[model samples]
Target: MNFKKKLSDILFLDIETIPQKEHWENLSSKEQELFTQKTLYQRKDEITAEDFYERAGIWAEFGKIICISVGFFTGLDENKMFRVKSFFGDDEHKILSDFKDLLESHFSKNQHVLCAHNGKEFDFPFIARRMIIHQIVLPKKLNLFGKKPWEVPHLDTLELWKFGDYKHYTSLKLLTHVLGVPSPKDDIDGSEVAKVYYQENNIERIVTYCEKDTIAVAQILLKMNNEKLLEDKNIIKV
Candidate 1:
């Protein structure tokens, strides 16, 4: 398979979110009591889904995009290089605004096909909602909501690996492991991101974690294309 044909129009994307926790704490006494009652756990030590939902709203506060990292990979003659650009800022609104700016002016203009692991379910919808909340228009190509499944150019790595078994879902890490991609032992996982964001307020850490995932996604793409992907060592901060 020709690498050029595979990567002719491709952009990989991922996002990190911190659901609304502070706002949930400000609920009135009556509301709080009702929420707690509804979320009571079956086991004394277990936390219920209700408890989590009551404590944290479904959506993060507008503008607090902990991380939104995107990678653009293409072939130049016989070589391929991926440029990963990111958007990170202390202010949630500013972070999201800058992300929207890049999507509209820089990323949105690219003709490349978009790819991600579980992007269709998580990243794409999350970004679309954020764009709508900010009133930022999505790029012409990315508006895949109403299109026929075959008409959409975006690819979800998780979806690709299911192979019609449909009994289980595979995570990016699991796929990378099975495919023999490089695994960094000290990499930050998503579970630790919210704590790192609110407790330490470390935007850089979040960015690094997000970048690692983007690279992992890129590696998955390379594997799918039956092409070799060189490791990128350059660290980007934005």
Candidate 2:
């Protein structure tokens, strides 16, 4: 399949999330009970709700986004570079608001598209949910209430790799490795994100990791189009 969208029209991004609270015990009695009910099926017969609490970051109701790193291609052909910027902090509202501002100010056009590895299932919906929680307006690219499927200005590298196969799932790391792109998981994996955020208190480290994933997504898109990956000097962090 041919890719019609121009590289410059795509904004590649990745997000890092952690459980709403550092520990299960920090939740109130009612909240704890609700969490127990929420995970009853997933935690059945083996683990208690508290034992499975660390996995809460995958759920929008129990999780909060701490970092969102975005990258965009600039220039043409061999002269292109990927410029990355990250919005992150302990304050979820501020982080989301900053990202929202970026979306509103620049990427709100109908021709622009937001792309991620598995954004449709994870990053996109997670951002929208957290935006609602923060009472921020959903940006045009993200607000999909009345838009048809083809009208949605969103792209997923994983979905593009799927072709017509719905049962297979390919991870960004695995795809990058197979496609001869740089691995973004050299420092840390998703499982360690919450620990790094809550225990290590290293927001910068998480931001760096998130930025790496954003770069990887951009590279994946380039590789899919039979284009060269960006050199180290061509990747700028802001």
In order, what is each prediction's RMSD in angstroms? 4.3, 1.0
* lDDT, model 2: 0.92
lDDT of 1 at 21: 47
* Top candidate, metric TM-score: 2
Candidate 2 per-residue lDDT, tens place, 1-238, comes to: 5677888889999999999999999999998999999999999859999999999999889999999999998999889989999999988999999998998888888789999999999999999999998889888888999999999899999999999788889998899999999899999999999999989999899999999999999988888888788999999998
- What would the per-residue lDDT of candidate 1 be over residues 23-51, giving only the tens digit for each residue? 45556677556555655553254775444
Please give the TM-score that candidate 2 achieves against the real structure: 0.97
Which runs of model 1 end up more than 4 angstroms from their true locations? 1-5, 22-24, 27-46, 49-64, 74-78, 106-111, 233-238
Which residues of candidate 2, in runs, are more than 4 Å off? none
Error of 1 at 25 (Å): 1.9
Worst 10 residues of 2 by lDDT: 1-10
What shift in Å separates residue 182 of candidate 1 from its native position after superposition? 1.9
What does the lDDT read for residue 122 in candidate 2?
A: 100
